[model samples]
Each structure stands twice: as structure tokens, then as C-alpha cells.
Target: MSASVAASASARAEGGKPRGANYARHYWAFAAPAAAVVGAVIVFPWLFTLFMSVHDWKVTGTVSYVGLANYTHLFTDDRFQWAVLRTLYFTLFATLAPVVLGVIAAVCFAQKFPLRGLARTIFILPMMATPVAVSLVWTMMFHPQLGVLNYILTSIGLPPATWVYQANTVIPTLVMVETWQWTPLVMLIVLGGLASLPTDPYEAAVLDGANPWQTFRHITLPLLWPFILVAAVLRLIDALKAFDTIYVITGGGPGTSSETINILLYQTAFAYYDLGYGSAMVVVFFVLILLISMILLRVRTSR
Candidate 1:
């Protein structure tokens, strides 16, 4: 018995087998359910979409392999091209306006003022509301007639303008709604960044006889850039995926003038029942988003 015990100890002191190896099967058994769920819910649908994109799929018609026909057609389709352009245009303004405004608001809010807490709370109220509800309220305010915005304009001796009813003004009007709802969120992010910043830089600038504008331009802006970039990235992604607000407010109206790629895809798949073409659009959109995300992430890592 002592000899057997000594052999066991010698085995452990040498190259003994790992305990985790014995439980590897159990680990896999526990993880299998979650992996199966993800495969079923997420993986299967995307695979199906990819399959449909390569074929001429329709609800009432027979499916036939198209071999990149849909993708080729998209290049020549004027409406699809316009939708892509509009999506880019809308995304740019929507992302930019909020970041700029939010930065300004954050700077102002960081200073001590009377009722600062109350003001911040009120400012964030719009962000807490559902996007659908916010869009619905803005829809009423955007009415060409019987809208309070126009009423205010007229009362101030200015001409009442058609807000979302006209093609030229629809994108801008929608962007205004986006900026109003999301600027507060950006402000909160920046405010958090401001709170964590070291005081050494500001103190050094003060000793150098820097004026307010000079200090902010040279010191504050540089230090806050990373935070600002983060805010911009978040806003950019949100603006790219924006559909509910645009859908509820304008319904892609004014004769397809306000239609973005998402709206176009919805109309193609559901309205026209061209599942193949719609899937193609979806693939393109996914590529676009992936490319943008990669670029942003690269920038972030480089910085």
C-alpha cells in the first residue's frame, strides 16, 4: 500500500493528466444548448437570406438561380442608386449635427449653474421616450397646416414652410427630429468623459496666461477628441440604421424622394414580393455597415 501511494505521488510530480480534460465533454454539454439556439435563430436566417439572394425568389413564382443578376441590376437601377445617395446624405447630417450640438451642450452643462441637475434631467427626457412615440409627436408638428411650428413662424412675420410635405425639405426636417432626440445622449457621454479628465492640463494652461477660447481650442478640444470620436461612431451607426422614425414620420413619401435604402428594401420585399432582390439589397446593406464599422474600429485602434 505504501509503494502504491508513492507511485501515485510520483505520477503527479511528473507529467500527470489534466483534470479539465476529464470534464471537457461536460463543458461542451452545457454550452450546446446556447450554441444551438444561436445557430437556429441567427445563423439559419442569414444563410437563408444569402441563399435567396443568389436566386430569383418570389412568393408566387418558382425559384431559379440568377447568378449575380440582381446585384448587377442594382448598379444600373436609378432608384436604388438614389436611395443609397439619400441614405448617405441623411446619415451624414444626422450624425454630424447631434455630435456638434451635444459637445456644446456638454461643455455648458459641465459648468456650475443654477438648476443644473433639473436642466440636465429635462434635456434627457426626449431620449428616454420610445422612438416610435417621438416620431408620432414630430409627425404632427411637421404637418404643413395646423402645426405649431408654422404658427410660430407666421407670428414672427416669416413665411410658413412645408416641413416634411415637400421633397427638398423632408430629409432636413427628419434630421432635425433625429438631432433633437439624440443630442442629449451624446451630451451625457461627453459629460462623463469631462468628469474623468485630469486637472493637470487645465492648471498648466492657466499658468501660461491662456484665455478661455485659447485654452479650450488648444487643450480642451484635444483631450476630448477620443470621447467625441466615440460619440460620433455611436451616432453614425444609429443614423445608418434609422428606420422607425423615418418610416413613421414620412412613410418614404413625397414620391420616393425621402426613401432610403432600408425603406426601399421594405418596399421591394413586402410591397413588391421580390424576395430575391430584397435579399440582395440586404446583403449590400450589411456589407456597407460592415465596411463602415471596420473603418471606424481601425481608426479607434490606431488612435
Candidate 2:
């Protein structure tokens, strides 16, 4: 670094700014390709979605400008409204479940124990697996009659119930699957936070005669709160846009009982071939998520 800078300095002293000019050119030269890819993929798709939102587009019909007609019809549609509600409902539980369980698991794993490393590795294995593969396995485990989960329940004098098949249990069951898969991620994040925490606070608290629970409550929880919120925000976004696991497990089954916005959008765009309406739904969902993110950010900053 010093040699390069000295060369540039000598070049400038020799009455030439070519070295600095070349530096700037090289920087942008390295950056331009990535910028171009981003524009082509991310920016272009978003622009297209926005454009289609205003047009009467469909699979087999002539695309025509429709202004806000698609958006208007989307809001008034009962199915879309229900799907939005379901998405929010799903997001709340799914986000909370992982965060809460993750915190507990992280706290436990942070402490010294026999075979602690092995246990943590085992715990995080589910998170390492692919979501689709996990969902497929859980699908069979959710089987009412012969599944291992039901067998264990029945052996414990509990009745085996159809999990993903039932309307009322469908969403919660899916949330459980999400929680099981993602809790370790939350754990990993919280564990990082925990590891970075200052020991002096805990030492002072202990010297101040604070009990274990009291020390953790007064020192640990407060410091950990920000990290928890980080995990919450990410989990909230993921849950809102969740599709793969839910699609594989329930397929929005039991008569749309567990359908969220993503599933609804897929069905609208592809199944119904209503591209314009689907695009409108995408725009609306995007706006809804944006509002939610802004609200979350406001709350986080306010705190």
C-alpha cells in the first residue's frame, strides 16, 4: 500500500495527475460490471412489476393500460384481503416463535456444559438442511396414523391428530415447522451477541449480590434486546414472504385455510392466469411490507 501511494505521489510531483485519474477509473471499472448486473436483474424486474401493475395483462389477452383499475379491484377482492390478513397473522406467530425459542436456546448454549459443542451442532443441523427437504420430511412426520411423532404422542397417552390436514391446526402446525427450522438461526445470532457481551457487567452484578436470574434480567436481557430485535426484523420479513416450506407442507391446503399472500399471489398469477391482477397484488404486498418495515424501524429507533 505504501509503495503504491508513494508511486502515485511521485507521479503527481512529476507534473502528472494520470496516477489519480487511473485510480478513479480502475475503481469504477471494477464496480461497473456488478452495477450492471444489479440493474439488469433486480431493478429491471421491479420496474416490470410496477409497469404490469397498471396494465390489464393476462396470459392470453391483449395487454392494455388500465391505470389504477387493477389496484382498486385487488383491494376490494375478498380473497386478497383474507390473504393479507393471513399473511400478517402468520408473520406475527412465525417471527415470535423463532425469536423466543432462539433466545432460550442461545442462553443455554452460551453456558459451559458437558458435550455442549456437540449438542449445539446437533441442534443446528436442522437449520443447515434445505428448507424444502426439511418440509418434505416434516410432511411425513405430520402424517396422522403411522408417523413417528404421532407414535410418540400415542405412547405418552396423547391422541394422534392430523396435523397439516386440519383447517384450524394448519397454520399453527406450519408455524411450528418454521420455528423448529429457524429457531437455531435466531440462536446463532443471539449467541454472537451473548459472546460479545462485556463480562464486567456480570462480574459487578455478581459482586453486588445479584442472583443468577436477576443478573441476567438486569444486565443480559437489556444488552441482548438489540440483537433480538435484529433477528426479529429478519424473521418478520422472511415469514411475510414465506413460500417454499408452506408450499411443500400444506400447499395452502384444507381449502385455503393456511394461505398467505405469497401462495395467493402464485395462485393468482399462474393458476388463474390473471397476470395483471397478480402484478397488482405484488405491488400492494410490497407496499404493505414496506409500511411494516418502516413501522418496525421507527419502533426500533424510538426504543
Candidate 3:
């Protein structure tokens, strides 16, 4: 009787194994569809782009394997090199200007003041506006002769300047638009950081007779560095990928002075119909962003 009972218990345990396997299979069956969607939507396009990058594919119905020719051409291409430099230049100013202004604004807003909520709401309105619409409005205001900006300048006893019409001033003008729209985002991030900072540091600073500036420089800034880095990373990425405002406002005009990598990529892929070369540019651009992100993340991690 004992032997028969042990055999029956072992048989039930063996039977449970198949039930567990079936449950796992059932889960995977449900997950497969979502995985397929991801592969179809995201993974496949990247693989396709990589495949096209190695070929001389054009919209003229010509396609041939070219290996690394397109990538090598980018190294020697003056226009491509200049577009990269222009992109970096625009990104630097766009990132720095907003971050600095945002920190100042955040500090100011953190203090108690009348109408603070109203001021903040008004300040962030630019960021809420659609980029294309904002660009259109700014374009109207950028007109050399008739724009309101120039009108204000002339009224202030200053000469009216060409905003985006000239090659030299085009990028800076675009950076101004970028800064205006995005500064509020940085401000919000920094403000949140300020709110969460421990009060112990301020109390200690007071005990040590430290002034507001000294306390902020010595304590607040160190504490806020991580938050600032987060804001900077976000701003840096957005600035690098800026297309709509630049496209809508300048359209890579004034003899390609304001043409960043994004504009150049668009023109190369769509206008010129050089899909292979454009794919190479896309890869390089992706790598550039990845490297910068890695570096910033390393800094954040180390800190």
C-alpha cells in the first residue's frame, strides 16, 4: 500500500511539469504579437536603413552595392563636413543659452513673490505653442524691413538689422527662437530640483554666516548639478534634432548658411533622392547622438 501511494504521488508531480510548460507557452504566444509589432515598426526600419546604407540606392530606380563608398564620401564632402560643424555650433548656443537663463529664472521663481503663478504660466506659453506655428510667427517678425522686431529697433533709435535674411545672422537668429521656446522647460526642471533640496544646508550656511550668493554657489549648485545635467541632456538632444523651426524659418536658405545636419539630411534624402548616402548620414547622426548621450550619462553617473 505504501509503495502504491508513493508511485501515485510521483505520477502527479510528473504531470504538473507539462502543465507548467503549457503555461509558459501560453504566455509566449500572447507576447509574440507585441514583439512582432515592435520588430515591424522599429527594428525592421533600422535594419533596412543599414542595408540601404551599403548600397548605391537612388530614386531613379538604380540600386547597386557600394559597400562603404557613401560613408567615405562623407569624409571628403565639404558640404557634409560644414553641415556637421554648423549643427554642433547651433546646438552649443541653443543648449547653453537656455540652461543659463533657466537656472536664473528658476532661482527667481523659487522665491516668494506676488503673481508668481501667473508669471510662470505666461513664461511657459512659448514652449506650449507648435514649433511650425511659432516659426511662422517669428518669420513674419524676422522680415528685415517690415517686421515688428525691426520696427522696435528703429523706434529705440537703433538701426534695423536683418534677422534671418543674411547668411551670417541666420543661425544665431534661429538659436534665439530655440532658446525662447525651450528655456521654460529647463526652468521647470531646475525649480523642481530646488524644491526638493534639503533645508539642512541652508541652516548650516546661516550658522556659518554665509550670504545668499555664497550659499548658492557652495551648496545649492552642487546639489542641483544632477537636475541641471538632466535638463541639459534633454535640451542637447532636442537642439541636435531641431528641424521644424529651422526648416520653416530659413529652409536652409541664405546660401546654406543656416543648414544644419538635419536640413542637409532632409535635402539629401528627399530632394536629391540619394537614399544610400542619406542612410549613411542617418547612421552617422545616430552615432553622434549616441556618443554625446553616453558621455553625458557617464558624467551623471560619476557625479
Candidate 4:
């Protein structure tokens, strides 16, 4: 028996066999595939964008390195500046409206109500709808003369205003469309968090003779802060990068009134055939997004 045990031990040592190594080997194997995919899809594209940003190369020509000239031109360009401002404005309204509406909807649905499931499903429908489809529908609805929205306004004795045709109303119209499309997403996220909350604190609050508003302000809001922040951050990022809806809805018009950065970049690259400048704009936007994400993450972690 001793001889046999010694032989087994010797074989194990010679083979470098260890039980803990199996877990490590398995973990690396699983991680390797994901790491390779991320590097190929995300990392490579990011690096390419960075490299392209510094060069003055057309879509079909010999490439020329221009260092920071593209970035300098971006700063000096008035159209780019206006696009940045418009993008910021859109981001602010788009992020805030949905989050506020969502919280309210989640709060309402958190209580036991008849047809609650159906209502929740209805609310989430818009979120699942394709952006291109939504934009197309909204485009028809924003028609100045015969659109449903203007018709409703006329019927309700309100002024029948030009929506997409006029510069003044374009941004607001886009914001309204965006809010309609994205509020359901915010509602779903907030609803999930609300549903997952423990009931004991709410019960205790009621036992202490707290009213609904008091309970919400003191107990519910504080606990739901993390989820709210997450939703807001997600919405903010998406709003910053908004493209398709704006592209289909306004096409960055009535005379650049609704030209967000993404739209500007698209117009620059494909519309005007300024590939290098457009790539620079994209790189700057990417960096801005990364910085904002980091800041938001830091804030969330701190909380």
C-alpha cells in the first residue's frame, strides 16, 4: 500500500497536476474568447478611430498625416460648435424628461392596481420599437399642415404652429419625439428596481403614521437613487450618441437648427466627403463620452 501511494504521488508531481489549477485553467479558457471578441470588435475600432483622427485622408486616396490639424479645425468651425451645443441641449432634455416620467410611472405601478401587467406592457412597447420605425412614424406626424399633432392642436383651439418646418420648434419637436420613444425604457428600469425593493421599511413607515409622500421622500427615494442614477446615465449616453432618429426626423434641419454632433459628423463624412475631419469629430465625441461615463460611474460608486 505504501509503495503504491508513493508511486501515485510521484506521478502527480511529475505531471504537475493540482486540483486548484483546473479552476484557473477553466476560467482563462472562458475569459479568452470574450477578451478576443472585445479586442477585435471594440478595441480595434477605437484604435482605428484614434489613428484616423490624426490624418487628412479622403475615403479613396493616399493617406496624409496631419497631426492635430483636424482637431484644430473642429474647434474653429462654427458649425461644429453649434452642433456641440445642440447635442448638449438634446442630451439634457432627453435624459431628464424620461427619467422624471419613468420614476412617476414606476411609483404609480408599484402599487397593486388592476390591469397593472397590461399597463406595464403597453408602456414598454415603445422602447422595444425600432428607432428607424419610430422616427418614420414621427416624421409623418410632424407634417406642418395635415399632421395629427397639428390637427389636434387646431381642434383644441390652440395655435396650429409649424413644427418641423420652422427652426424654433424643431429642437422641441425632436425632444418630444425622443421623450415619447425612450420614457418606456426608463420606466422599465425604474420599475424593476421598485419591484425588487423590500417591503419592510414601507410597512414600518406606515406603522409610524407616515403619509405616502413622507414615506416616498424619506424612504423610497433614497433607496431608489442608485437605480435612478443608472437609468439617467444610460439615457444620457444614448442621447449624446443619438443619430438615426434625428437623421430620419429632421435630417439636421430646418437649417441646422437640430444638428447634433452625430448628425454633423455624418454630414461631414458622407454628405460632404470630409472623412478625416469627420473621423476627428468622432474621436473627440468618443473621448467626451468616455469621460462622462467615467465621471458618472465614479459618482454612482461614491453613492
Candidate 5:
């Protein structure tokens, strides 16, 4: 036993490689429980969803195997195709608006001011508020005749616009509401990144007589790209999965005009009782999100 132990110790010290491998193995052992939990909660559900997607699950008929039929059907389905377009449209504005506004807000808040803390707290309040409550409040504000927004517009001698009432304006109006609620979250993320950034560049830029814009362009933005990308990824995901706000605000519009993939999924699954179709939609949606994520990840890591 002593000879064997000596041989093992000698092997460990040869490159100190075995020790690292052992540590990694031990670490994995410790992590296994959490991994299992995650697999059970998230992975399994998605696997089941994939399984359901390939079947014709119905209330009355026996579940029938459909292979990739549902996915093929999605490509040809007009309503689903339209929802895809609408979702992409909403996502574009919703993601970009918040990120742009958030970066501006982060830059502003990062500077020292008298009431900075209080102001930041107030600014982030919308993000912390309950989604349902926020939707309800906005719903009241969207009321054309009684809404304070219309009152303000009319007082300013502008036309009182249909906020979420008109099909043409509903998606943009919802995007506006989304931007208000989420901009602070992106601001906070960017702020954290800004705080951690090395000050050497900025100090050097100041000594070099670079203006605020020049300094930001040369120093701040390059370093901040990673954080901004992270925020964009988060916002993209949130915007794609957005249902609560739209559901409460427009319930998918003056028709299907404002309907997104998420709304369509819900309507198909629950309202229409087409579980298999809904599952297929979910699968396609997941794949789309995964593709976007990969693209973003590539952009984030690339020079």
C-alpha cells in the first residue's frame, strides 16, 4: 500500500497535471447536484417540448407522430409567418431603444452629481415595479379620452393620438412602454461595467485634450462594448419573450396586428387547444433565439 501511494504521489508531481484533473473531477462532483436540478427544471421541459412538437396532441384524437411536419407547416403558415415578422419588428425597436437610452442614462448617472443616488433610485423604480401593475397603469394612460397623455398632448395643441388603440400605432406604443420599464435595467448593467473600467484611458485622454465625445469614442465605448452586448442579449431575449405587457396593454391589438410569437403560442396552445402546434412554435422560437444568441456571442468575442 505504501509503495502504491508513493507511486501515485510521484505521478501527481510529474506535471502537477493529475492534481488539476482530480480537482476538476471533484469540482464536477460538487456541481452535479445543481446540474441535475437545472436539467430537471429547464432541460427536461425543453426536451419534452421538443417531443410534443413532433406529435399531433389533441383533446380527442390519439397523439399521432408528425416528425418535422409541424416545423414545415410553420414555414408555410401565414398567421405564424406574420407573427414572426411582427415579433421581429417589435423586438428590433424594443431592444435598440432601451440599450441606446440605457447607455446614455448610464453615462449620465456615472458622473457625480448632488442627488445622484436618489435620482438613480427613482429612475430604476419602473424596473422594480410589478409588471402587471405597470401594465395596468399604462393601460389607463393609453385610454384616449381620459388618459393624461392625451390631455398633455391636447394642452400642447397637438393632435390626441391613439396610443394602443390603433393597429398602426399599437406595437410602437407597446415598445415605448417596454423601453421605459427596461431602460433602467440596461443602465444598471452598463453602469456596473463603467465602474469597473480602468481610469487610465480617460485620464490619458483628458491629458491629450480629447473632448467628451472624443474621449468616449476612443476610451469608454471600446471597453464598454462587452457590457453593452450583454445588455443587448438580455433585452433581445426579454423582448422576444414579451407577453405580459402586450397581453395586458393590447391583448394582441385591434386584430392580430400586434400579435407576437409569444402571444400566438399562448393563443394556439391554450385558447385554441392546439398543444402540438404550440409546442412546435415554441421549438422554432427557441431555435431563433439560440441563433441570435450565437450571433451576439460571436460579435461580443470577435475583434
Candidate 6:
């Protein structure tokens, strides 16, 4: 009986009935393709960028080793310094504006109102549109003389100021454009969180004689903190990497006034043909993004 049982177990094991180790092997086989895809698409490029950051590689010639020269040069370069500062400024304004507006929009949309569905679709349309197309349309609207914006100002008996011509206004204009495009994304995220919230706390607050403002401030805000953090982090990272709209609208114009880090990297790589330096900038930007994300994650997790 023992011999027969041993033979049966061996047959079952060999006939696709996986043992413990074999199960693990099969599981890895199922996971390997996804892991390889992620590594190839994401990890490999990141590692390559890091490697290139420490070298002086030209587009046409042999690569030379440059220890920390690229990083040091970036610090000293006036254009790069300006780009970094401008990037931070953009991130701050872009992130805050959208988050604030998104919360308001979410609150408004959370209530049942007439044509609410249509209103949401309209609000989110800009985010779905092609960025390049939006940029082109805005560029026309921002034209100094004949643009719709200037025309409106003139009609109101106000002088038409150059919107994108001056360095001071260019960054703000870009921020406005970014905010217009991304606020809906924040709204959607916040709305989801709001929808998921339990009604009991709100009811209890009402019963406790809490006013609307008090309930929102004390209960809703705290409960929605995680979603807010998530939206802010996403917006921050995206704003840091903003390029297409600004590139199309300003082209980092008026003497690089609105140039973000991504724009700087693009100029370095393509216009200046300094592949190695550009790659180093990319590496620095990547590290900064990773650090910021980690910090945000830590804060969220702790809470």
C-alpha cells in the first residue's frame, strides 16, 4: 500500500500537479513577462540616463569621461540656474492653483444639480484635447495686438499689455494655461474621494450643530487629505516636467524667461547638441522627482 501511494504521488507531481517549488517556478513564469516589460521600458532607460550623466558624450564623436563636471557646470550656467528656479516657480503656482480649484469644483459637482453630468464633461474636455492644439489656440489668443484677449481689454477701455512678450508675464501665463488644463484632473480625483466618503460623519456633524463650513474644514478636509496629497504630488511632478504647451506657446522665448528644466534639457540635447550634458540634466531632474515623490509618500503614509 505504501509503495502504491508513493508511485501515485510521483505520477501526480509529474503530471502537471505542481509541488511547492514547482508552483513558485510557475508563478515566476507568469510574472516574468510583465517584469521584463517594465524593466525594458522604464528601468533600463533610467539606468542609461544615470550612466550617461557622468560622461561627456557627443552626438557625433566618442564619449569621454567627465566626473562631476556636468553637474558643476549646470550650477554655474546662468541659463540652467534660471531654468531650475523657473521650474520651481511653475511647480508651486501650477500645483497650488489646480488643487485649490479642484477642491472647489469637486464640492460644487458633488451636489446634485441640473446638467451636472454635462458640466463635468465640459470641464474635463480641455484635459482630453491635444496639448499642441490647445497651445496653438492660446498662442493666437495671446497675440499682442489682434488677439481676443487684447481686443477684449481694448473694448473695455483698458490698454492691451503684451502678454507673452515680457519675461515677467510669460511664466504667469504659462501657469494659467497649465492650471486650466489640469484642474479637471484634480477635480476628478477629489470627486472620487468624496464619493467614497461615508455619510455617517457628515450626518453626525450636522446633528452636533456643526455648520457647513465647520464640517468641511474639520471633517471633510481631514478625510480627503490623502487624495489631496496624491493630486498635489501628481501635479507637482507633471508641472516640473512641463514642456509641450510652454514650448509651443513661448518656445522658452523672450530670452529663456519661461524655460523649465525639461525645456533646458531639450535645448541642450537638440539645439546645443550636447548629449552628455543634457543626459546629466535629465538624471538630476529624475533624482529630484524621485526625492519629492518619496517625501510626499512618506508624509502621506505617516498620516
Best by lDDT: 3
- TM-score for every candidate vs. truth? 0.85, 0.90, 0.87, 0.90, 0.91, 0.89
lDDT of 6 by residue, 208-248 (tens): 99999999999999999999999999998999989899999
**How good is model 3 by TM-score?**
0.87
- What's model 1's overall lDDT? 0.91
Provide the clashing-pair count of each candidate structure: 0, 0, 0, 0, 0, 0
* Model 2: CA > 4 A from native: 1-26
**lDDT assessment of candidate 3:** 0.95
The 0-to-1 C-alpha lDDT of every candidate, in the order given, reads 0.91, 0.90, 0.95, 0.89, 0.93, 0.91
Which candidate, 5 or 6, has the higher TM-score?
A: 5
C-alpha lDDT (0 to 100) for residue 245 of candidate 4? 91
Q: How far is 152's C-alpha from truth in model 3 (Å)?
A: 0.9
lDDT, candidate 1, residue 38? 96
Evaluate model 2: give its lDDT: 0.90
Least accurate stretch of 10 residues (summed lDDT) in model 3? 17-26
Lowest summed lDDT window (length 10), candidate 4 = 17-26
Q: Model 5, stretches more than 4 Å misplaced?
A: 1-23
Q: Stretches of candidate 6 above 4 Å error? A: 1-25
- List model 3 lDDT by residue over 1-303, tens digit each: 999988877876979764455677678888899999999999999999999999999999999999999999999999999999999999999999999999999999999999999999999999999999999999999988889999999999999988899988899999999999999999999999999999998999999999999999999999999999999999999999999999999999889999999999999999999999999999999999989878999999997
For all the candidates, what are their Cα RMSDs to the real structure? 7.5, 4.3, 8.7, 6.9, 5.7, 7.1
Candidate 1 vs 5: which has more TM-score: 5
User: Which structure is stronger by lDDT: 2 or 3?
Assistant: 3
